[model samples]
Target: MGDRPERIADVEGVDLAGKRALVTGSTSGIGRETALALGRLGADVMIHGRDESAGEAVVDELAAMGREATFQRADYASVDDVRALAAAVREWTDDLDVLCNNAGGLFREGKLTDLGVEYTFHVNHLSPYLLTAELLPTLADDARIVTTSSGAHRGVDIEFESIRSVDSYSGFRAYQRSKLANVLFSNELARRLDRTDRSITSNSFHPGAIPGSGFARFLPGPLPRLFAALGRLPMATTVAEGAATAVYLAASPQVEAVSGQYFTDCEPETPSAAARDTTTQRRLWEESATLLGIDEPLADVEA
Candidate 1:
C-alpha cells in the first residue's frame, strides 16, 4: 500500500464509468484479467496482491486504459495483513461498488497460520470472510460481492471442528472444504443482507478449470506439469475465459438484482445439497464470526 503515482482519472469510455472496484489477488491470472476488464468498463480499479511489482504493473495497465488504478499489497496467509488491506481500502474510497474475492490457492502441506488455522482454509475462506466483514461499512448500498468458488465443492461439506486443525490433512481435501466455505459464505451473506434490507448482491461462481495460471504452478509434484500440459490442450480454458464469469457477475445488468446463488459460465446453477443447507450455512457464519472475533451485528436477530 505504498505511494504510487496516478496514471489517469478519466472514465469516459465504458459502461462502469464512475464505479469503483477492488479485486484481490489481481496481480496475475484470472484476477488480473478481471481487473483489466473492469477498468475497460470505466471503473476505477484497485488491485490487491502480495507482489508489489505485479500489482504496480496492473495499475499501470489500467492507467493506460484511461482508468484510475491503485495497488494494495496483502498476504492472505496472515490475518493482520487482511485487516491492513481493509483499512487501506477504506482510506482509498468511502464506498466500493464491486469486490471480487479472487485470491485462493491449494497448499501442498497443511500448516497453521498466525491465527492458528490451516493455511489453505485461512487463505481461501477465512481471510476473505474477515476482509469482507471488515469492509462492510465501506461497501456501497447496492455493491456486488462476487467470490470465485469452484465446482470442486460438489462432494464436500464443512467440517467445523477440524477446520482450524491440521491433523490428518490433505491438500486436495483442504482445498475442497475451503471452496465449499466460499459458497456457504456467499449464501449466508445473501441471507443476512436480505434481513437487513440492504441492496448488496452476494454471489459465488466457478471459474472452470483454469490451467495456465498460478493454480497449476502451486500444484504438488508432477501434477503441476501434467496440468500445465493439459492446459495447452483444447479443453483447458485460458485466463480470460476463466475470468469471464467473475466479470459478468461484477458488471452484468441481468444479474443486477440477483443474490445468494452459485453460478457457472454466467448462469445461475444450483449448488450441492450440502451447500444449500441453511442450518449449516448459519452455523458456519456464526463459527466464522467467533473465530474472527467479529462482534458487530450482521443482521436482525430472529425471534
Candidate 2:
C-alpha cells in the first residue's frame, strides 16, 4: 500500500467546450469526481445513477461549480433501462463526446438479473457493454469511452465456461472476473471501432483502490472502516485522486492516438496475459454480443 502512486495533474489546461460527456454511477465516489473534473474542463456533463435524489444532488453540485450538468437514473442491471436511457439521453444532445462506464460493486453473494446473467457480470461488465453498444449511434468520431477497471483482475483467468458460475463464488473473485472482462472488452472494442472508420476509441484503467467508496457500502460497516484506516496508511487513493487516470485517458493529448491500451496513472501498461490474448479478446466480444442478444457482430478492426 505504501507504494501506491500519487495523483498527478495529467489533464491540466485541457478544455472540452461543447463536448457532452456521461459518467455512470456518478452519484458518489470516483464516478462523482470524474464527472466534476469533466465539467470543470467545460464539458456538458451528465451524471448517472440508480438514485434520483443523489443524482440530482450531484447535478446541483456541478451547477454550483458553474458546470452545465444534468441527471439520469437507471438500474444499469436492466438492459431495457439502459436502452431507454440511451434513447432518452439522445433527446438532449445529438452526439456524445465521452462515455465513462463507471458503475459497479462487489456483491457478497451471487445474484442474477432478469436477463439471467450473473449479478456481478451484469453490473460490472454487461451494463457498460450494453449501454455503450446501444449508444454507439450517437457517438462522434474520436469520441472516447473509458471503463474503470481494477487491479483485482489479476486474480482470475478468462474462464468462458465458469464466468457465470453461481455455485462456486466469492465476492472478490466475481469482482476480479468482471474487471478482467473490462480490459478484454476494451481491447476488442478498440479493434471493432478501428474497423468501422468511426474513429471512436475505447480504453480501460486501474483507478487505484478507494477503499470506502460506494462500491463497498454493501459490505458490513466495520469492515469498510477498517479497510479505510488501512488505506490511509498508503494503500488507497482518494476518490478525487483515483479519477486522474480516467481524466487523462479521456482528454490528454499524449494518448490522442493511443487505442486498445490499458492504463494505470497516466501511462500505458501491459495488462495481464488474458487481457493481451487476441483470441480471448475476440471470444469475449462474441460471448458478450450473445449475452446481450446483439445480432450484428461489432465491425472488425482493419488490419
Candidate 3:
C-alpha cells in the first residue's frame, strides 16, 4: 500500500478522447474526484449517485471542462435500481470504455436488505456484481472495470450464510466481508470475461483510509469527529489521494494487460490467500447469480 504511484500525475498523459465512462457514486468525495479526473482526460462521463442536485453539480463541473456529462440517480440498496441504472447507461452509450464500480459504503446499522441479505454486503458487493453483469454486454470490447475495494479486506473470507442475516453482525466485520467479496467478484469477473471473445479487464484496489471521503460519517459516535481530526494531520491521505488508484487503473496504459488483480496505491499487490483462491471466486459468482434469481452470467464459457 505504499509508494502511492505518483497520485494523479500517473494518469496525466492518458488521452481518452471519445471514450465513454460510467463512474458510480460520483456525487461526492473519492467518486466525485475520480469523475473529474476522468473527465479531464477527455472521456465523456456519466455521473451516478442517489442525489440529483449533487450529481448535477458534478455534471456541470465536467461540462465546464468541455466534457459531456450526465447524471443518473440510483440507490445500490435495490436490485431494481441497479438494473434501471444499467438500462439508463445503455441508453447513453453501448460502448462504455470504463466502468468504475465505486459506489459502496459502510452501513453501521447492520440491517438486512429486502433480499434478506446483510445491508453492508448487499450494498458494497452484490449490487456492484449485479450492475457489472447487467452491463457486460454494454461494455466496449476493451473496457476496463475498476472496483473500489479496501485494505480492510485482508483478514476475512466470504460467507453467504453470514451475509444472509444480521444476527451477530458487527459493522466492521460486515464491512470486511463485503470488501473481500468485492475482490473475489472482480477477479472472477475477469476470469469469466477472459473466456469470452472480448478483451475486457477487471481489477480492484484499496483507496486507503481517507477520513474526509464521507465514509467516516457512517462510523459510530465520535469516531467521525476523530476521523475528521485525523484528516488535518500533516500527511493524511486526501480525498484526491484516495481516488488516485482508481483513476490510474481506469486510464493508465501500463495496466491494460493486467486482469483479475488486486491493487494498492496503483500497484498489483497480492491480495490475501483467500482472495486469490479461484474456487472461492467462481463459487461466489454462481451463488450471487442464484441469489438474484438470474442465469449464471457467461455460463456457456465453461468452468
Give the worst 10-residue stretch by lDDT in candidate 1: 1-10
Compose the digit string of candidate 3's lDDT tens values, residues 11-116.
7778989999999999988899889888888889999999899999999999999999999999888999999999999999979999999998887797888888
User: Could you tell me the lDDT of residue 136 within candidate 3?
Assistant: 90
TM-scores, each model vs. reference: 0.93, 0.92, 0.96
What's model 1's lDDT at 84? Answer: 95
Q: Which residue ranges in model 3 land beyond 4 Å of their true spot?
A: 1-9
Which pairs of residues collide in model 3? none
- Full candidate order by TM-score, most accurate first: 3, 1, 2
**How does candidate 2 score on lDDT?**
0.82
For each of the candidates, give the backbone clash count: 0, 0, 0
Model 3 Cα shift for residue 196 (angstroms): 1.1
Highest TM-score among the candidates is held by which one?
Answer: 3
42-159 in candidate 2: lDDT tens per residue? 7889988988998999898889878788898889779988887888779878889999989998888787788777888888888888888788888888899999998888857867
Q: TM-score of the candidate numbered 1?
A: 0.93
How well is each residue in 118-197 modelled by candidate 1, as lDDT tens digits?
89988999999999999999999999999999999889888888977999988989999999999998999888887766
Could you tell me the TM-score of candidate 2? Answer: 0.92
Q: Indicate whether candidate 2 or candidate 3 has the larger TM-score.
A: 3
**Residue 58 miss distance in model 1 (angstroms):** 0.9
